[model samples]
Target: MWVLVFFDLPTETRTERKVAARFRKNLLDDGFAMFQFSIYMRFCASRENASVHIRRTKNNLPKKGKVCVMQITDKQFGMMELFHGQKEVEPEQPSQQLELF
Candidate 1:
């Protein structure tokens, strides 16, 4: 599963870079990859991993800003590709079917 996070905050010319740096550091610490400015992407093996990242981001944010987080399954990513006219190929199924005779 992959998670996407977005956030908007008051424009602080001086602190923008600093804040962004801190945010990136925190996300990296939480095992997230930087997808874009104010956005993060993360792959988790379990829901618990996702939750931990969410909680940490929320806790580490500055006092005077707004943030939003979204979690999307691999299916959602495929849908995004479809919008761009990229069809996703499905993997082949096993040829042998198991059944009790």
Candidate 2:
């Protein structure tokens, strides 16, 4: 599963800037990679794992901003189409193989 996080946070005031920075840091600390500006993505081994990360993201939401988070299966994410200007770009690659204990 893929946990997609998209946020638009206010950066007008110093405090807002700090908040936005902290949010981005938190996402990185949780293993999310920057898919684009203000957008982060993480891969989970299963739906349960994705849910846990989603909950963590929700818990650390900033005070003032728009945040949208959703989960999609790996197959769904794989089907995404990408383009860079007129040239077509390849979609993002999935994470490393899952580990089994």
Candidate 3:
């Protein structure tokens, strides 16, 4: 699963930079890659991992700043197929057994 995080915040003061740097460091530590300014992407093993990353990122941001996190599976991207012509795709069925189990 890939998680995309978009951060939108005002950088009016040095304090803002310090806060942003902390968030960036935390993201890098968690295996996130910088997709763009204030945006990051990460490959997570599970929804729980994505949630934890989002929570940590949110905690690192300034109180006034805002963050958006979106998680999508590879199947979802394949269904969109934006580069190619749009086609109807059958929804994927859930696995009968958990991978961990």
Question: Which pairs of residues collide in model 1?
Answer: none
Model-by-model lDDT, in order? 0.68, 0.91, 0.71
Q: Whole-model lDDT, candidate 1?
A: 0.68
Q: Which stretches of candidate 2 lie over 4 Å from their true place?
A: 97-101
Candidate 2 lDDT, tens digit per residue, 1-101?
Answer: 89999999999999999999999999999989998988899989889989888999999999899999989988998888878889888877776865679
- Give the poorly placed runs of model 3, Cα more than 4 Å off: 78-101
Instruction: Give candidate 3's TM-score.
Output: 0.66
Specify the poorest-scoring 10-residue window by lDDT in model 3.
Answer: 90-99
Which pairs of residues collide in model 3?
none
The best-first sequence of candidates by lDDT reads 2, 3, 1
Q: Could you say which candidate leads in TM-score? A: 2
21-52: candidate 1 lDDT, tens digit per residue:
67768878876766557777776555886787
TM-score of 1: 0.66
- Could you tell me the lDDT of residue 8 within candidate 3? 77
